[model samples]
Target: MSNRTGLARVLDDLGTTLIDLVRGDPARAGGIGGVVIDDPHDDQVLPPRALVLGVGVREPADVRARLDELGVLGAAGLVVRGPVVLTDEVAAAADRSGVALLGLAPGASWTQLAALLRSLLAEGEVTDSETLGGTPAGDLFALANAVASLISAPVTIEDRSSRVLAFSGRQEQADASRVQTILGRQVPARYSQLLEARGVFRRLYRSDQPVYIADLPDDDGGVCLPRVAVAVRAGDEVLGSIWAAVRAPLPADRELAFCDAAKLVALHLMRQRAGADVERRLRADLVSTAVEGGAGAAEAVRRLGLTDQECVVLVLALADSHVDDPAEHARLLAERQQVADAFAMHLTAVHPRAAAALVGDVAYAILPTESEDRALRIATDFRTRIGDRVVVGVGPVADGLTLARSKAGADLALRVLRAGRSQRAVARVSDVHSEGLLLELADLIAERGDTLTGPVARLIDYDLRHNGNLVETLSAWLDAFGDVAAASAAVFVHPNTFRYRLRRLAEVGELDLTDPDARFAAMLQLRLWRPV
Candidate 1:
């Protein structure tokens, strides 16, 4: 049945239903005795109060089976005579089926059984208090207060984060000071499992009904408590759950109430989560806005409330899907403590990459210490462990405002890297001077290479290629000489035809041509190949 099917009439009247069967029976009048109903005593039973099934005489063969079926339909006990008509096999079968078999036929009547149940149901006052929070905290509080009074075990109301909100009765909430902050904090990973309960909370909160989980392991990983949490939500909003763990398996009514509690939590969670979202967005916006333009890296450091003096810059890039994952970013940020430990003796570092933690496809962090080697080591280590393509641009050691310029230097180091080959993290941009003699030499070659960009460059390239063999062009010249005995003899060609062309001087670049200027330029260009 849906949890929304709240019972309207009292248990007293429902208790009377058990008596009607005996009244209509013929041979079973005096053969049946009074009925007995057990008080639930905080045991959540459906039909709610304990109710009788059948009382008196030998039971029909299917009576216990029928009672077993009715137990699910919400039956409690059956008052049958001692001498049952059923065979021994059948009587034994009844015992195993969980039907309460009692002998009351000799003295009591159906009327007496009905009266007793009615009296008990009335005295228990099951009908008087049945309101389960009509979307009102007052209502929940009222019900919760009463439930706390009834329950012997401690009860707690917590959000998805496991932070207790409303707890009642004498149950002590976990002590905040006792080994909590000193050792470890109990932070729940709700984002991992919130997806499952989110749907139910949405439904319950909208309908103001209850949600139930009969089998209650939220996370099979064992860290999460394996208890059923009933959730209540307000339209599209999830608040929290009502946690109950006293019962072996939760009864239907308690399940229903848990659902109600879920709705309660959902209503609260939705509203709270929304405002929290806005606040986060605003904070993100402000932080971003605070750090823009040339002052961006510096401003970012300032906005993050971290000291900038100990920062050293290291740039990194990735080749995977981790461009902007928030959780991963947070994890990288949290790794700061470990990073500090790793670099304890070197220098203070402002972790940089694309994100504050530099865990993304591209990022750079400024290390505070002067040792570029140590910073590079740390950055390179991170790159290796994460197995991502990262370019480490080590910024020079600069004090305060100069650090901003150092970040600029990091950018330049990366530019130098692109011009040639990859570099280690220890390579900084400031190490290069544009006016240096080597740089000037490389610049000359670059311009020369550009001017000879087409066929001339291709010719030089080809001549230098294939071990500088000019044989093909030489043969062509020889063929043009037309086999003249005199011309052929001049070029030392054998045979009367003399068809082979003379070797071309330009094509035979293998001789090095004995040109001092060209040789000198080539050597200088090779020496200056590394602009840095």
Candidate 2:
């Protein structure tokens, strides 16, 4: 395929020797699809995507009129001469029309630029020269350096969000902006602000072709370097981008080489993603085996490289919403799992001994902690880092052998949170103890029904038959620990009336009202069994 680049890049490659007095928003420069050398008087036809407008000197009115014509023809940008006096009306028209305005150096010839661009546009495959001339084509750093050498510029590989992944390590060509971006592994906020202002990110995400940013100025209009970037994609999915900083437009050969290198970069990203998926599956299997109480559970934990830790705390997070479509649900589940793996990677980066897994839509982490405080900190960090998509549940610290119990605790906490039984984002095992126990008991009560608790069942039957508040009064009395006034107030009834209800309950159920053991059983039953 023909190597495609953005207009901004084309300008940068041209350099000050060939171009000067560039006006209009540099950020709005479109992806250059072809070159259009305008005849002095003939009609001009704009090309698809983006096209470079080449013209000789024209009056300001003519310039504005051409801009209008280009805008109507859906032209991406325009290119003109520096000596061609640019009027405010023309500049305003260019800005309003979203056409990138370019002015060439006084001595620059349109013919030279046209020849250079057309040749590059026609060139196809790029041969590897430097690191990949004789060496294998698998090393990522080598690929980056090779592309840089081919283009005679500093190169950096970045993801879609402009995060610097690898650089060619060209110290001589590195500027303040490049240095900071490499060191921080992301574009600096100030630089990002300038690019964002011109809608560069929006255009980058939308276009598959290379975006050329020429002489990008700082937010304060300070001189900035020029860069050419092309998205590394697999079919329709954009994986990352390759950037090259150059003083002049890349030669046709080098432009072809950069395009070829992009295909390799796409392969690397796809392999990386596949490897991560395999790692997640392996880690999840280990965690599942450990939590399911297998004889090899300790072996599995050891395989994860966790040792010399006093305790392991388990944390689980579950997605709050569900999707009905199977494909979409699976995609969402995969995204969630990727998020969980990233969480695990973050934990390991900080603590070295932490491990995590994704079980369906739920995420689980087994973190080695020195103390309760550290575990709490990890839990808090998780809550802050994972954001609002999932509800977190933290289990108490336990030894590796008892990891299953901790996992169960976390699962219970997650269940409670999902059921709307808790308001906190990070629900701890201790926090959900009462609710968890009640839910477990409720399961057993539901399975056994009336056979499990005769007295509570009798009271429930009596209330159902008479439409009375006997069950509520009894439950409130037990909840208040046998306090008459508190229980009466809880039921919104007079103390004397509650006392009379208690007497009637005791007589109807044939139960003792004074025995503490019997009262405790009744309290447990009341908490578990649903009243009729």
- Most accurate candidate by TM-score: 2
lDDT of 2 by residue, 94-126 (tens): 877777667765544465556545433432112
Predicted structure 2: lDDT? 0.68
Which candidate gets the maximum lDDT versus the true structure?
A: 2
For candidate 1, write residues 258-340 as lDDT tens digits: 55545544544453455445544543443333222244645655654434454455544332224378987776554543342
Q: Each prediction's TM-score against the native?
A: 0.37, 0.63
Q: Rate the local accuracy (lDDT) of all candidates.
A: 0.41, 0.68
On a 0 to 1 TM-score scale, where does candidate 1 land against the true structure?
A: 0.37
